[model samples]
Target: MVRKAKELNLKNNEDFALWKNFLENVGINNFSEEEVNQVDLTIGIFDKQKLLATGSLAGNILKYIAVSADSIGTGSNFNLIVSELIGKLALKGIFHTFVFTKPKYVTSFQHLGFKKLAVTEFGAVLERGFPDISTYLADIKQTENPVKKTAAIVMNANPFTLGHKFLVEQASQENDLVYVFVVATNAGLFATDERLKLVKQGTQHLSNVKVVSGGSYMVSYATFPAYFLDSPNDLIEYQTTLDALVFKNWIANYLHINTRYLGSEPLSRTTSIYNKILKKVLTPEISVKIINRRQLLNGEVISASNVRKKIAQNKLNELNELVPETTLKFIRENAAILKLRIKKGMKIRGN
Candidate 1:
């Protein structure tokens, strides 16, 4: 009989070793510190002393899932693991959940009510529960007024720099309507609400631009955890391809978004790769526009990363040229809080 799934203590050395070895045995490697550090909880099915199957929850997204192939009982192990994970999430008032898994196992998750949002050759993104992609799109449609040409831009906007403003200004000028989807992930130095507020304030003058949260469908932990994690190139390619396809298939298709505007990535290898994949997957159906990076008078490219470094180093005077007055004011007011976060080891170097 299959044992009931129990929470596995990843902090325990023995448990961590068993979990890592089990995942490796099932062909799931790449246990980088950034990836492993994101897991909030892990659950496993064990038959007496032997492990049968295991899965993990990292925020709202599932990760590090594996099952022993030779387990004796019925094929209920996968379902049990998923059900347990969902149950744990529900306890935390998180009814919506997502999973990134192999293409072959997409049907397995579908059996348990996970809808496939996007699928690539390397991986698939699936989500289960309330306020799914359909609901998100419906809400967006309710707020929008139809137009002849529609464009979209997805941005993390860690602190909303002038470069981001320039990109939005360009798209707003070119299209009848522009949707600025601020990435909803709260992993950045600036919280999600702060980032959204900054974007709205910075672009308030542009009447055609609609600043909205990207929800869990954009470059979120659900669709692209690699954006936050230090991931390998192959892993980055897979995650980015899935992220781009989701935009093309769901967001772009439902909202009639015909163009996606992206800033040229002269820094951040991860973002450079993501831009390339967005072009590869979003074109032909949706036009991809790459705007050159906005630069300062000194010829230095304006980026949120550089702005964040200035904040960390207490170089507020240098930020006036990099960010708009609105963002500069926010930084000045929240300088202490922002520096506290950095002192507490918040990563300011990534996208």
Candidate 2:
């Protein structure tokens, strides 16, 4: 008989070694600090001092799940690990959860109530529980007329710069209604709520534009964790592909979004790759409009990265040319705190 699942203290060297070896044996080799540090809790099933199965929870996301193949009741052990994780999440009042697993394990998770949101050749994204994709879509306020031209834009606007404002303005001019889905992941210089607020304030004059949180449905930590982690190209490809497909299959379909807008990425390799994958997956079904990135008269492209760099360097005077007044005001008011975050090792670089 298998022992009841118990919390594994990864801080302990012995427990860490067991968990690491178990995951590596199961073909999960990526144990980078960026990824491991996100885990909030880890649970393992053991039998007579041998680890039989293990799983982890990171802010409602299930990861690092592994079950011993030679162990008796392997399927039962897998279910037990997942059930423990879900029970823990429920205790935190988190009903919605998500997981990214191998394509072969898709059906296994499905049997545990996880519905596949998107599946690529390399990996798959699944979700389980209330306030799900359906709830996310249903909660969004739709336009008065369903037939009107509608466009969608997903942005991580770390601090909403003028370039983002330009993209929204262009979409507002061309489409009757525009949905600006701010990337909901909070692993950035600015918090998720700050980014969303800055974007809304920056574009408040646009009558047709509505700014909303992307939630865990689009470009979230669950769907595209690579966006925040220092991941390899293939990993980025798998995550970006799944993220795009979720937009195409669920978000666009439900909202009647006919077009998706993106600013051309010339600086960030990750975002450029994401843009290409978005076009590859979302085009033909949903029109893709790639607007040239807004630039200043000095030939420097306005970007949130540049704005962040300015903050890091204590160069407030340089930001007026990059961000709108609203964003600039926020940064000026919070410059000390922003600099403190950078001093404390908040990455100022990257998306």
Candidate 3:
């Protein structure tokens, strides 16, 4: 009686408790309460009579993959659920995929078209045809010898779109290597890992780029506010500056990045303001380059808000035009689930 459905409402504490136990039983203990809530509702799987397993499609990686202890090795349920999830995301047109798997389940993932990456202290990073994120970025840090030009492209993927591709391509041309860091905070529509994977898939062909999660200490999804309150613009500006300072300082110390690139969009209220303030405030140590905003097929500027509006209207065609082909396909395949995401929160439509 195992079946896949896209509209199951499982937000209650009871449901979360069920998933919490299931995930811990599988050895993934560091994930938080907020993290589990970011699952795109549509990708959640139900067994014949109970919620037994679940996963979410993020960037090029399939994340939060878990199965109930009672359901482990029970028939082909695990295989079936994961296959369906991947199939859904694949239809969104993403070519390469990634997932974190238990050491014992490495073979199972390989059979499912994923190649295991060397284990990190955190977890096993796996991918298929996607560049190894760790080595993807070109060495751009300038030393006494003038290290190659390197740029850190930071984002809260919130589901990467075609606009992201344009920005990356623009930055990659000027730098030897582009480090794409997906903000690993629980503050937005998608969890940190999911957003990172989406960004990875959207930008995989760019040879000089690497994608990785911005760890908690540097940029917190938990502490950062995706939506500003009715507070004054200066306060918002102050907060933005503080966060930017924190992010830049960490990248310099940890990743050796010295240059940063951002998109310049005149229409985004928050970003436009942040840009104006940041240009003056960012330390003199790192170079800041802002690419002009990218445009949509209609010749108007494309934005995350616009893409979301199209998705909310079920206008898949328009959404696809705004996102990369892979991103468009991913959204369409998960359309049913994605549609439900609209109802989740007041501040973050998808997070």
Candidate 4:
């Protein structure tokens, strides 16, 4: 079971010692007693006799998301603790949440309504507005107005690549109508409108797929908390789980849509897990389909990260191999950013 940090008895020497042990075990050499004291709260997952995983929400930022060595791959325990924590936090009015993590972990946060943003080598950051569960549910309920099923594909489309085209195409095939939810927030590598334009251009062939921006009411930006870069999976599971519930209910009741299609890939954690939960919970009335991920090369995986890396390497030709010709052309024409990134890489190499 998991409980809030303030409720736990931590005045004992043993409690302090345990926290210290965890810090040292994780190689947090810079963590100070003062830092620990700064933690406003914490949530821990305990087994019959021991704490197996824990997360801390301190100074309005989530930190120390860690699982016991023995409890690494088992994602359930972690998710349970996180779910409890987030519920508590939400009730307390802590609506916006942020997390810093590797790009690969983006999907984990996605499940919770978090959208990933670019950051320095420290880590990738994901942010989402709070009470999203409620808002999402409201949206789903609104879906009832139209009987046809609808799926919203929230994308940043930096410059719609082939992978983006494939994902949209696959999504289109499975739904009656697809809403391409373009990120209007100024949180992408490219301007939101530019990115949206590329998506509109790339998906010109799909009439059923229309583009819409994540307008002011759609996302939480200026009010988000600090990024939880090192926190365990607890935060990811907790936040996203709520988001999925909201989205699910909204899709079922509001949109009158019962089915959603998503790409399948290791990078797609939120979609995969959300679908799993939705399939299990949504009555037979609603369904979810997991489509296989698209691959541009024979065996290589297609990913935005890989494309960015190629762009950094000035691999324009290779970029073509991964994206559509239209996307490639857009990227080539906007090569200044790519050039600047390359120069930055060279500076780092020189250093």
Candidate 5:
């Protein structure tokens, strides 16, 4: 007999509760609060009143998948569920998609069009069609945009501090071209649009730098959740490794990016772990540089975390010293709005 299935609105309390309970029963509880709310779409097969199988997508990345024990024998239900998700994405012109799953389900995902991009100790990151990347490369090769030596830096310059400037400046100086991918997801104190603008203003002085958005490809389950969730160490390492692998295997190849640059992370364990994984996963063809974190006059580290703390304690003057002049202007210009957001539970956790 065919199973009953339908799409769900997570904003609906009953649907949300059912989904959470289903995941809890299946022992798959590591996603962040943001992921829970940001689901682009979710569907589940139900038996009577019980949710029998379920899956969700957040910007082309498949996540929060679980199936009832009774449905685990074969790939029929699995194939149907994923095929529909891919269909949904395709309807909207999202041909390329990715999935992060524990190693046990890699075969199940492979049965559907997903190919293994990379596998880590905790999980395997897989993908279907990768769009745009190839087109970007083709456009470059066909014209004068052929950069001989290129570098990449994925940053969440939340407030665009002096430290961020130092890293971008260093990358611009060393590489013939630098692609600065600002994290595009709106999961920070300052919205992504503001962050993008700040990065552009801060890096405008660098003649060789070009700033771009990391559109659903940069921060995924790996480095992102570790910042907010009580994530397992294995997931933290694996997710981070996979993010770097995608860049080295795909983005680096497409845009002639031979180097990846990052500011040395001294405080955040998540960032430090991500930096370590990038170094190890990137091939010898691509160079990885971890610039030392910038510091202030009192010998203290110049950090976004410190900047956030100072703001919380009403130390605007001190924040000015740690960030670039551009960032300081942004903070002041949006002070009233910032207060409302921060007061309304917006967090300032270090990126």
Candidate 6:
């Protein structure tokens, strides 16, 4: 900013429209109502009368930031807002913070000691050190007798499906060992614990298949911001590449994984693109294979989203064709709970 703001403003709704408009000018549209409501703290840097630069922090993630085009060259307001956000976090004894921003802003954050944890063409996830990838990688319980040609699958089995089962079965049969890392992020319809349980029971028959929590390294808000945004594009590429990098640089080596398996995403465009990005990012040492999605007898592809839609629409019989017996059993066990969630009109992630 040529003329920086003197101080930050209090959290109020008066400046929200201003904030939203600013972010929109930068080609960003993911800021949702739920996320805005989650903001427990927001500080806008004002240039006396006008809001020149502003941002907010919630759940330790910095977001909803925008700056005037004129302020692009000046570091004054950028530095000011970041310092204020960090200071607020520090007051709470929070040493770590995460920032979700565009690729263009990575350098500004780097100057503030933030590490580039994940970046995609559309969005970049940077962290100030609240449990980075290395921290998550350290938590994995490697097999005692690690297999030489190990395969890995990172999935958020939002109730687990036959498609997921098929992928696991193939990986396990092909490789000496397979690690099924269930995504631990808490954004899905089912809680992480529930998802983990379902994934475990659904894939328990394969002795070579190890079902374990992804521990925040896979599809996590830390690496993928699209989890928060529904309409994601080009940015998914960078995020996926960063994901593969984490696996190649960290998880792959630790777990003796030379091959990462993925089911061909026939449903979500973003995921389909992400699969392509993984092809480019995964080094030659590690092979990535995209398996075809399992299909129903009617030829429709099986997906968790399809399973959820069936449950939501009360088409229980159709699910029999879309899901494995194990998943069907689990859904039956939790029928009432699933029904209640569906009735409440909760936005269940079918994917």
Best by lDDT: 2
lDDT of 1 by residue, 200-315 (tens): 99999999889999987875533354422223546777877888888899999888999999999977777887788889898888999999997777888899999999999889
Encode model 6's per-residue lDDT on 1-351: one tens digit a residue: 244444333344556666666667755576655566667777777665776777777767787666667755448677888888888889998878887776788999999989887566666667786666667666664665776779999898887888888889999889888889998877766789988888888888998888888874675623444423435544455566767776776788777788999899877877777777777888588899888886766788788877788878878887887777877887888888988977787676646
lDDT of each: 0.86, 0.87, 0.62, 0.59, 0.76, 0.74
Cα TM-score per model: 0.91, 0.92, 0.53, 0.51, 0.79, 0.77
Would you list the rank order by TM-score, best first? Answer: 2, 1, 5, 6, 3, 4
The superposed Cα distance between candidate 3 and the true structure at residue 8, in angstroms, equals 36
Give the range of the ten consecutive residues with the poorest summed lDDT in model 4: 217-226
Q: All candidates: CA RMSD in angstroms?
A: 2.9, 2.7, 13.7, 12.3, 4.3, 4.6
The alpha-carbon lDDT assigned to residue 341 of candidate 1 equals: 95
Compared with the true structure, the alpha-carbon lDDT of candidate 6 equals 0.74
Shift in Å, residue 202, candidate 3: 1.1
Q: Write the per-residue lDDT of candidate 5 for residues 116-159, one digit (tens) a residue.
A: 86666566777788564555445434225667878888888877
lDDT of 3 by residue, 260-342 (tens): 88887676576676666556656577777888777755787677667777777777876656778777777777777667766
RMSD (CA, Å), candidate 2 to true, equals 2.7
By lDDT, highest first, what's the ranking?
2, 1, 5, 6, 3, 4
Model with the higher TM-score, candidate 1 or 3: 1
**What is candidate 2's CA lDDT for residue 322?**
92
Residues 1-351 of candidate 2: C-alpha lDDT, one tens digit per residue: 748777999999999999998887877778777788889999999887889999998888898888999888999999999999999999999999989877888999999999999988878889999988988888995754585799999999998998999999999999999999998878899999999999999999998898999987765533344422223657777878888888899999989999999999998777888889889998798999999997788899898888999999888999999999999999999999999999999998887
Instruction: Count the clashes in each prediction.
Output: 0, 0, 16, 18, 0, 4
